[model samples]
Target: MAAGRLSFRNITALAPMVRVGTLPMRLLALDYGADLVYCEELIDLKMVQCQRVVNEVLETVDFIAPDDRVMFRTCMREKDRVVFQMGTADPDRALAVARLVEKDVAAIDVNMGCPKEYSTKGGMGVALLSDPDKIEAILKKLVTGVSIPVTCKIRILPSVEETVSLVQRIEKTGIAAIAVHGRFKEERPRHPVHCDYIQAVAGAVSIPVIANGGSLDLVRTHADVEEFRKATSASSVMLARAAMWNASVFRSQGLLPVETVMEEYLRYAVQYDNHAFNTKYCLCQMLRDKVESPLGKQVQAAQTNAEISEAYGLQEFYQQTQDRLQTKRDTLQRSSQPSCPVMDGDIITMAIKFERREYPPQITPKMFLLEWSRREKLEQPRYKTVQRSQDRAFQSTVTVAKKKYRSSLWEKSKKFAEQASAIVCLRVLGIPEGRLGEDDSGLVCKRKREGRSNGNSEEERGKKLHVEAEASEPAAPAEGEGPNHPTQLAGTL
Candidate 1:
């Protein structure tokens, strides 16, 4: 192995299992004794459209989709040991994705062993295995374009000679390693893995070969990992079901009880703020046949992380982690504020953010501002939002009546930043943004009261009176209408 490059020699790795190779599980695998971890395979098309975001609250780097959902999340801890496995058939799209994530991961592995229809139909995964030319093209592109090591995982062909021939061609692309899952394209876990065929492929290729698909028959404990490695004559062994069942299988001492492993996994889940549903799914996978047990049933019924933690007797840990995250968020917010005054052509701005929890469900400040604009027969509000490159935070400015308003506080999403700007505009105009009691009175109505206070300067008082006089006439419902009777705005905001 070269300096700054990943080495697969004599290592135990976690195989990339869809929906099972998520963050919490990968962290657990590393906490045990696994040498490397592969994140779940993400499609190139979906990955290409995502914007990278640095999440200060969770201390993770997030790839956010257009819908504001996190497609992938990784922290600095796994930057050197994590393998970003991607599903792609096109050489250009594959290279594009490789370059996008090259800095955040140790290596990029192309997934070619998946036999599912979704992958094959898209000319990816097992589909690429049949088209050797496309596979070579994709691999060559990644090897030449990315600075990190490149690898691929594949299922063996029916004949050892054919698989060896294919791998020999793949080795010419200069990939650092290759993983051979000892099964044919149509074979499942129930079918026995062909260790002899894997040995043939490993023998033919000079690059490191990672042996996979041994969980069902060979791998169960730490010693089995070496046995599987020797059986296939590969440089490393990757375990899927065995590690998923009990990550501590990587422990040299022995396999620990599944219950103990699950508790440790939950701590990582809570610490990382993993989604409740993903945590539950991984726990259920650990439970397997025992899902009918009382603890499993309790976990299955949980809707939130707190509930899941309670089911595992980790509620105190969950609460402490949440409180710590809140404190970190507040600190980051304060540190992110501009040291100097913010000015847009001589207009000073105030810092703000749209807190969804502070408003009634389905009601937003943007909706209210748009309605107020229409009722007063003014131009519709227009928002210009930009994402900061340093931390991927979003800031938006909204223009109404030839005046611009913006929030200095950066938001996690563009939609939220736009709403924040709208809140600033509504507050300055003395318009009710939401109901007082149902919503957070301090945030929703604080500015409305400030606009009417005697502490305002004469110039500020004149501006407020002018705006209120313009909106006083009955062109529509009054500005102070409560949340129960908000003016309906057409179309989605």
Candidate 2:
């Protein structure tokens, strides 16, 4: 490897998988002795729109989307060992994404091996294999444009000679390393990997060659990793399905039981505050054929991390992690307070952000506030929003029952800022914010009437209100529902 680049020499690594290569799985592979880990392949188009955020509560650096979804997350623990992989066909777009994340990752890997339609339809992934000139341009652009090591993962061509010629062309682009998945573009997992083709490419290229695609056939155990490396004559070995099924396959001693590995993975999932759906998906992949077992059925039915923890008998661990996260958030909130307590106009402001994970899925603070207003027969809330020119962060103030509320913290989008303001109002009014632990609070604001001529049940009404709140701005106050009406305020605790 060149100076300032990650070395791919004689090491075992976790391959970049579609959904299986998330933070929890990457951290687990590191814990079990993998030399380097790769995050899942992200499209360059999606990455360019993300805003990087330092999440103090989760203790990770998050690339958050405009809708507040986490596109990619990594903590300081894996700073030097995590490789970011992205799919792109354009040289400029690929360079833009590489520049965006070069400082945070150890290296950048262009994904050229994926055969999925989603990647190929966009002229990315395996589609790059058919365009050698475009591949050279993209790789060279990244290598010369970014400060980090640039690499590419590619599938073998139809023949060994063709594969060697392609890798030799890739080497001239000044990449630090190349990972060759020893299969043709049309080959599936059931087809045998062509180790001879990988070896030919390794021999042709002076740069380090990382061999991949030998999971179920040649590489089943920890010891098989070296066997696969020797067979392909490559600098290192990368595991996907083998590591997905059992991350401890990287352990030199022996592979641990699937159950033990699953339990340990859940611990990391909870500690990192991973999304419940992702955690469950990784667990199911580990289960494999055992997915038909009773425990598997229970895990399959789980909708939340807490439910998954109960299935794995790790509820206590889950609760402790949640409690620790809450405490960290509270401490950070206090630390963000201004010492002089300057007032914004006449209303006092406090720091707050709308953390989507704290509430149930598809539920927001704005939805709760809207339901409350309708229940009390008060006018709908109105919001005044503004976006900062320099950073594009938005701040909003929402009026409920003639009282205006706003958060000191600016959010990434107007919707999030409005939700933050609603949170402040909900807190001041002594109402539950409908967080996960609040009992029946989400249901309290629903209509009490059992029957309606319009045929909208309580659930239906709540869903309709949620849609209206999210899709449109707050409605204007009625003629008599102005601030001068002097309505009774909800009592504070």
Candidate 3:
């Protein structure tokens, strides 16, 4: 709201994603542009013993100056679901984290909105918002224990009056600032954000009260900031998916080095390359839009980042990369100018700029069948063992007669039935079922149903399934089928 550079040296803040945005990503922003980086929320118990969790929270980030602030949000291992945590209700535990804050972080935050069942069982987050005294005690101790500022992010409670009352109580505890997501903890992502409640909390709290919720598009980001300025007189609004949605949109308003912001992001994210496939896989996503650009097209042609890096002569690869992007400007300028062939001597009326045909996104019948199989959990016909198991679990509803009838056949018919069932489930799932596992050829499960009109053609898909079954069946090991490989249970089964 204040020209994209509102100073937060002492006032409140807006750290958009309360979860999922890894520490490395936050650290990158701290380097690129963030007043303070909040580490991914840490379960206080895990905080005490799990370095792995701590390391995960710390990955891919370094936005802090030697003297700048880092904030650690204390949380309960609500993922465990075995206990009810009353947030940082335990003053001693809250103080222990506050002490950690004293070491290197710029500040400390107490999480009151984790929405996890385990956290709820522990009586923390929205579950504990009802108990103001516990919230009060935790904040008081945390504030008293830490030397730097303390902040709170609340996923607006279901009850407006209750939230406002809680805000008043929260303010009494001396927290420096508070942010309220417009939706209740469980309702966001699916339900629309409710901005009015944020306005109420902002009005109720004397300290900087930031409003958060829907209208997070670029236009909405600015509008929310404007709204916050008008409603509660807060100076700025936080950007969540709004900024991340189009991470570069902030550049011109002084978000220079936009490309590097993304590059740094890649550095942080490249880890967790679980299958060694994710790094390239994710880079492809980041580059998807960039590739549509002129320079991006060239970068994508490199096939691999190493090639792109070699082409650009830079190790940190990004398409339409900052360094090489300039060369494209001239080409783009030339292309934008009208190109006339001067057909029949007169300037061809409208530079019939052959609009490149974009591939139309289409879903076919087999895909529809696969979706059905996933959603309806169709039975596997070839494997009676699997059909029986599905019947016991009630996961598949194929009639017992169908299962018995299919199983009575030999390889070809049985395989056809199983493929039919899988295709049916895939159709029910309607998207793609679980991502093609590692065995898939780059998961390219393209089913081209362009010419076939008759239902009879489905038999071909069944034939392919039969081939796969034959391939997977154990070949007699000279001595003949004594026992198949013990670890052979995985595949289409």
Candidate 4:
């Protein structure tokens, strides 16, 4: 190759061979003497809205060393409101996002390759590929606005002619370089990769091309790269899971994997997870392909069979017995792979650093309040509305704490209610005015409904005298004094 770089299946490297990291795992951290480390490809617009989510991402990547050559990758996908409602797209949405993430990384990449429907709806991700003009506009805008190198990922179109056309069209846009995901997105699942598409696109465009997809392990990576080299006569390759899960693969000088590695893997998994089940799930995937390897040839390729059976002849369940936190089956069934992975040492360390621990997360009072409210008699507390159910209990707890702060007010209101009706009626009836005349005292009423007013007036006058006598009368005191002196009690008591 003129560039002096080695060739892999349709992927060409320009001399400086670099090791790259996969999505979520950055390339700069790996010690491949990489050209640069690019972050994952799914930093969506929603991330911009939620300061907490944005802060978490920043903290994870904030410590990027200068020599590490860190960079950010955001898929230039459609702005699906459903996907990004938590964070949405404003006219200055891209610029707003750029301001938040402090970058020491080499470049900021906008993704246009992701084909997820939610992404497309947002007018950002892979949908841009359908219109080169729009992508060029986006690229030009980003290039002008940002200070870093801007790059993009492309996919082969259904027709080779279209792929060539798209490449030639995008090539003129003046991006720093380009990479191609060889499969037509429609052929995502198990379709054969047409490596020639990469070659065609490379020839069509003058920029550097990075090849992606297909090779998952070193055994196959060697073969895949070998074919890739033969097919395109190009250099360099990109890997995801293999490079990330086993850092040794890049450093192994091509050694085949072993069961001992799996044992170490389990050790790390337990260490990182602290007995959580996620470690188990990852362990199962890592050991999935070993069945055909030398250590695995003795065993059958039974992915579903988690219990290493006598038929496969490999069972070292006792490895887990040493740790009280772990337990393993003496024998695995005739399954294809174990449900969970058990990892060891460096891999575990790498995971512990990159992957978050599955533990009881730190919570604030507000989270507890939300959880408590969810359990309230109200139709449904706000907990159901929150996407994160795990924090519901915490959020509701805070809700109740605030309620506690105001509970005294509620109790005081309840106590006053018993006398409220009588108080209100007395006020309404014009509280005693000065004299207790026949009418004002309620001993007589001028009722039109009565038989006769004059007759009632004369009867009232006579009744009034009796009413006064009764009002002036006093009963004997409780201890048998003839009567209490009203003059003394009213004046002094």
In angstroms, give how far residue 208 of model 1 lies from its true place.
1.3
CA lDDT scores, all candidates in order = 0.82, 0.83, 0.44, 0.37
Off by over 4 Å in 1: 1-4, 339-349, 352-493
Worst 10 residues of 4 by lDDT: 347-356
Provide the TM-score for each candidate, comma-separated: 0.74, 0.75, 0.46, 0.44
Residue clash pairs of candidate 1: none
| Backbone-clash count (model 1) | 0
Instruction: Give a tens-digit lDDT track for model 3, residues 1-493.
Output: 2112223323222244434244434444444334444455555654433221221221211222122222232222211111111235576787775564343455566777767776677776676677778888888887777666666667877689988888888988877767676778778555776767877776666677665554443233333445444553444455455444334322325443435544555554433211112223433444545657754555556554445444344565443342343234224433554443222232122111111122112222223333343345653222221211100110111222142211111111222334333333332323342222312221224443231334546566546544554564333222222121111121232
- Model 4 misplacement above 4 A: 1-38, 52-92, 102-104, 216-219, 222-230, 233-235, 241-247, 256-282, 289-493
Candidate 2: stretches off by over 4 Å = 1-4, 339-348, 351-403, 406-493
How many residue pairs clash per model?
Answer: 0, 0, 44, 72
- The most accurate candidate by lDDT is 2
Which run of 10 residues does model 3 get worst, by summed lDDT?
388-397
Every candidate's CA RMSD = 9.1, 10.6, 22.3, 26.9
Instruction: Residues 260-308, candidate 2: write the lDDT tens digits.
Output: 9999999988888777889999999999999989999999999888999
> Which tens-of-lDDT digit does each residue in 4-112 have in candidate 1?
4778888899999988898889989998889999999899999999888888788788888775667788999899999999999999999988888888888999999
